[model samples]
Target: MTYQEKKSIVSLISAILIFGSFCLYMYPQYPEGGLGSAETFRYWGSFVLILTVVSIVAHIIISIIFNIVFRMTTKEKEPKFMDELDKLIDLKANRNSFFVFIIGFLLAMSSLIIYQPSQMMFIILIASGFISDVMGSVTKLYHYRRGV
Candidate 1:
């Protein structure tokens, strides 16, 4: 009902999404034939890799849109549904999250140049970005409420 409540709900949803993704990654394993371990490159390629790329990009875009809408709502004479604080926190987290991916990507490339790390670089980057975003978002919320 309150903006803080909305923010908390959104944060929880994001956390659930992240945890689910991790669970998907950590699903029970069995050895693969020649496709490589960690439960087949194809499975990784299909869901974890390809589907994730699309969804993550969509997530970013949706976040941006929601933030813009939240801000724009304030410009109207009518009271807005969302607190600007929520938008700020989300954007801060999103920005840091984007950089998280960038760093992960760069690290992946560097690692590949030497030798493949026997894992998909993209997955690591995505997971790191998600976790970092969550942490950043929570920190921002604390700072915001504390007026620090």
Candidate 2:
């Protein structure tokens, strides 16, 4: 497969891992309220948040490394852009990311306004919104045959 195809596959896998994290988190809460005490909540919440952040940051760093490795292995200069398809491919990732972020931001604010979700939920929502923005770009790239 091409580098772009490989990159998008890895990103999709990362998104799935994140979605898995969300699932693991929700499983405990399914029976009813999440635990009894505030202290218990704090510990678990912090644990999950730290783990999620670390996982995502690690994914990004590793992805950058993978791209570098692939480039080095291929020993070819990266593709240059002078044509219409190149320009479109170059801009599509950023354009879609920005659009998703703006929309997610608006949605998050409206969600907070109407539902008044807890502080933790607000934080998670914000994090997930950003994740969704990135996923949007990755998904677009997959369809458009662009690399990260």
Candidate 3:
């Protein structure tokens, strides 16, 4: 498989694993207060902020490791530049990812309109963010494999 395809697959798997493990680690730490309590909000707020930072750092580390492994195994240098097709594929992936996140955002809002707990809104938002990351990776993989 090509480098882009391999990278995309690694990204997809890493996103899933990082999110899953992070959620598992955080689950038991959830505040035991009432759902709408200040402590509960603080917990969810920290959850989202920390997840963002963790995901960014993990993806960067994984990308660097992937490049090093690819060089050692295949003896091929990573592409030095993004060509037109690469740019286009990336743009499409971003657009799709943004679209998914916006939908999630709206749904999260609607949860409030429907009188769901604030925790439910946070949950929807978090899940959407994770799904968007996965969607972007999948879009890149698909375009690379299927000719745009």
How many clashes show up per model?
0, 0, 0
* Model 2 regions lying over 4 Å from their true place: 22-52, 64-90, 119-134, 146-148
TM-score (C-alpha, index-matched) for candidate 3:
0.98
Q: Looking at model 1, which ten-residue stretch has the lowest summed lDDT?
A: 74-83
User: Which ranges of candidate 3 are over 4 A from the true structure?
Assistant: none
Better of 1 and 2 by lDDT: 2
lDDT of 3 by residue, 15-52 (tens): 99999999999999988888879999999999999999
Q: What tens digits encode model 1's per-residue C-alpha lDDT throughout 1-148?
A: 4344445446646665755765566565423555355556655555556545655675676556656665677553323554676677657756766777677778767767877654656457656656665666565666456543
lDDT of 2 by residue, 1-148 (tens): 6565566666767766665676577557533345455755665576557666866796888687777877899886444434565456547766776666666667667776777545444455556555764665476566566343
| TM-score for each model | 0.55, 0.55, 0.98
Q: How accurate is candidate 3 locally (lDDT)?
A: 0.97
Segments of candidate 1 deviating more than 4 angstroms: 9-26, 29-31, 34-39, 49-87, 118-123
Rank ordering of all candidates by lDDT, starting from the highest: 3, 2, 1
Best by TM-score: 3
